[model samples]
Every structure is written in C-alpha cells, then in structure tokens.
Target: MKGQSYSSISFATPSPKQYSETMLHAQQNHATNALRSESKIIPACLPTPNPSSPNFASRFRTDIVQLVETSNIHKHSDTCYKYWNANRGDKKTCRMRMPRKLVSNSTIDPATGDICMRRSDPWINNFNDYLITACRSNMDIKFIWSGSDAKALVYYITDYVTKT
Candidate 1:
C-alpha cells in the first residue's frame, strides 16, 4: 500500500482493493477514537485538495450522486443505474446507501458472493483519476458492515457526496 492512493472524500468507505494494509493499521487505531470503530470512517492524515473545497472543478460531474439520492427510487434500481446485471441468474444486489429500516439490503449476490456493481457506475468507484487530475480522490464509499455508526452512516454519506 506504499504507492497506493486513499480516499479523501469524507465518509468514504475504502474499497478493499484501494485500501489494503494501511487500513489495517487505521482499523487498529480505531480503538483510540471509538467513533472510528462505529463509522469505519477515520480521520486519515491524507494531504490533498478536496473536491468539496473551493478549488473543486466546477465542470466536474455531480449527477451520479444525485441520481442515487434524489431520483425516483423505482427508476434508480440497479438496472436503471446500470449497477447490476439482470442477466445474471443469482442477481445479488446492494446500495451505497439504503433506507435506515432496510439495513439488511446488500448490493451483492448472495449466491455468487460477488459485488453487484457496474464498472460504469460513477458513484460506485474511486474518482481520483477521473474527477481530479492532481488530487487523489475517491468517492466510492463502501458501507460499514456493523457498529453504532451504521445508523448514522446515511447522514454522513449525504455530507460526503454533497461536499463533492
């Protein structure tokens, strides 16, 4: 993980691929800050320009997060957003954000155990290269599997996206 990049988008859930050993250390440090354990969103010392900052590219796209949060839920299904494969028989699914009561929803295939995400889904991946030319940015936030922060993750997520 020495040369690898990390997400600066606050409330971002570091995808395992992008975050390997560095997060392991960060996870260990969570005991120091109990909130980190609950949210799995640590206050990393990553130094970079943030998209939410004033310098963010005004031309950069913001519709991806919009489609997920505000668009018609029915129309924003995995298929509509192109985040899932209807042809796949197992057809497991999950969401970056879900209704508070619908906590058990998984954007993964139960049978296949594969993450049901589309490579094309902008909101589902790190935006480092695509969104910023210099800053290492990652907007694709993974969900916290458990902890007290689970209840408040949606609120934090809104902040993360809107800041972008």
Candidate 2:
C-alpha cells in the first residue's frame, strides 16, 4: 500500500510523574539486565534522569532512539509472507503489515474523520516515545477511531485470552 496512510492513529504521552514512576519501578525491579540480555540495546544500566535535570531531554531522546532502533525496527521473516499465494496471483505481503507508508504530518480526514499520525520511518513499528522509554521494550500503540477498530481489538484480545 504505497502512499497509504493509516486511517486513524494517535499517541498518548504519559505525564512526567507517570514516566518517572514507571522508569523508577523498572529500575527497582532490576529489569535493566533483562532488557540488556534480551536486546543488548543498552550498553549499561543508566539511572533514570530526573525530569528537571539539565540533561534529561537529551538523555531521554537518546534512550528512546536506541531502544527503537534495537527493538522497533521491523525486519521481514518467513512469517511476513506466510499468506503469499503465487497461484492465486496474490503478491507477497507481511501479515503484520511492515514497511508502512510514511506520513508527512498528522491530520484528520474531513470526509472519513480518520486520523493519520505523522510517520517518518516506514520500517519502524508504531510506538509512543514515553512508553518505549519507560518500558524499555517493543510496543505497538494505535488509536481506535471507529467501531470496527474497537471490535477488532476486542476480538483479538478475547482470542488471545482464550487461547489454549
């Protein structure tokens, strides 16, 4: 889907307190080592910077960039083309729909009321800056804008919960 922007997308930014608490909790739980071992993205366990610190903005941005580069960048695998069917003339496509179209800016569609969030990178999964920084893990965040979207999310959650 070249040049196709997402129909509805939004990112919720966590409050400073929320961010700080989450980061503090993560540090207290010793999740840094686990994150390092799992992704090796972080070179060392860095203390969570205070919001008011002079270097907090730079440090936070650096951490988010590193985490996103390590975990949010999408790479194609066999599963990406599992539904490909040359016989049916179906072009190979990733089920998770990686390599999404890049959006220049966030806007709401006048006719459809769909929100298209700005996306500069086509291969990076949707993420929230605060979430990835606080959780230090891969995450996908999207806004539910329509009834269909809400229904689909509910079904997916239910299916996952009921899975044997």
Candidate 3:
C-alpha cells in the first residue's frame, strides 16, 4: 500500500438529474427573502475625489476606519479588505501610501471613548448628502456593501454629519 499507484480507481460523479436538482436548489436559495433584504437599503456608493481634498479625505478615512474597527462584523478581516479596496484601489498600494486620519469635533466622553451623536435628528440625511456630493465632486467613488443591511446608509449619515 506504500507508494502504490491508484490511478485506476474509478470515481462516481453525480448523475445529471441530481446535478440539475442541486443547481436549482442553489438558485432558489440565492433568490430568497434574506438575500432580498440587502436590496432594501439603498447603496450609498460614491466616486473617489478628483484633486482630492486632503481635509475631507483625512476626516472620512479616519472615521471609516474607526467605524469598521468598532463594528461587530463577524469577518472583520474580510470587511476591512473590501473597505480598503473600495477606497484605495488595492491593499498593497494603500499600505505603501501614508494615510491621514480625520479628527472628530464631537464631544468624546473620556469615560467611554465614544463619539456621541443624536440618532433622532433629520440632519443625518443632510450629512449623507454632503458626503455623496463631496465624493462626486472630488474623486472617483466606490462603495462595496459591508454585507450588513443598512451599513451604506449608516456610513453616509454618520460620517458626514459628525465630521470632526
């Protein structure tokens, strides 16, 4: 049995009917209510800026990093990969370049290290609009959904309104 040739062993492939049924089930699963939930929230993807605003970029990137770092996403590494790629083209190139972190103007509770904001106000939408406008005017924008429903909406609202 040691170093024996086993090339003659036959493999049993699934029959065509079985394969077709599996494919159909997969397709059905792909088109389910859970999958459809993601579509309910609008994608807030915007363009990367042209002649980028250093201030805006710094603030946005820092805020986004903080958000991602703090988020409860299960696969944090994969989320970071998607986010970094969407913002900075590729991981290697971005890592090579120096990044600017945005300063927050919000009152940070020394006790909690949390940047607090009121979630009850209409200004959230305004902030989202501002970010969308800034991205459109300044750079080529790309937004990859974080696989969490409402993440895009939350990012736009929080990043712009609570600008530090």
In terms of lDDT, which candidate is strongest? Answer: 2
The C-alpha TM-scores of every prediction are: 0.22, 0.67, 0.16
Model 2 is weakest, by summed lDDT over 10 consecutive residues, at 1-10
**For candidate 2, what is the total of clashing residue pairs?**
0
For residue 79, model 1's alpha carbon misses the true position, in angstroms, by 9.5
Reference-based lDDT, residue 141, model 1:
41
- Model 3 RMSD to the real structure? 23.8
> Taking the tens digit of each residue's C-alpha lDDT, what string does model 1 give over 1-164?
33434334423222334334433444444433365346655233223335675423321222222222222122236554356666765455455443213212226656644443223323333233333333333344444554444656878778889994
lDDT (Cα, tens digit) per residue for candidate 3, span 1-164: 12322222111122244335434544444433243346652122323333355334333333322222223112324433443654555544233122323223324466644443222221111123234333422221223333342565788789999999
Candidate 3: where are CA atoms >4 Å away?
Answer: 1-105, 118-120, 126-130, 136-164
Q: Which model, 2 or 3, shows the larger TM-score?
A: 2
For all the candidates, what are their Cα RMSDs to the real structure? 17.0, 10.3, 23.8
Which scores better on lDDT, 2 or 3? 2
lDDT of 2 by residue, 1-164 (tens): 12323223235333344346545544543544476568754632444546786545544544655576678788999888888998999988888888888776688887776777777777778887766666777787988896667888999999999999
Best by TM-score: 2
Return whichever of 1 and 2 wins on lDDT. Answer: 2
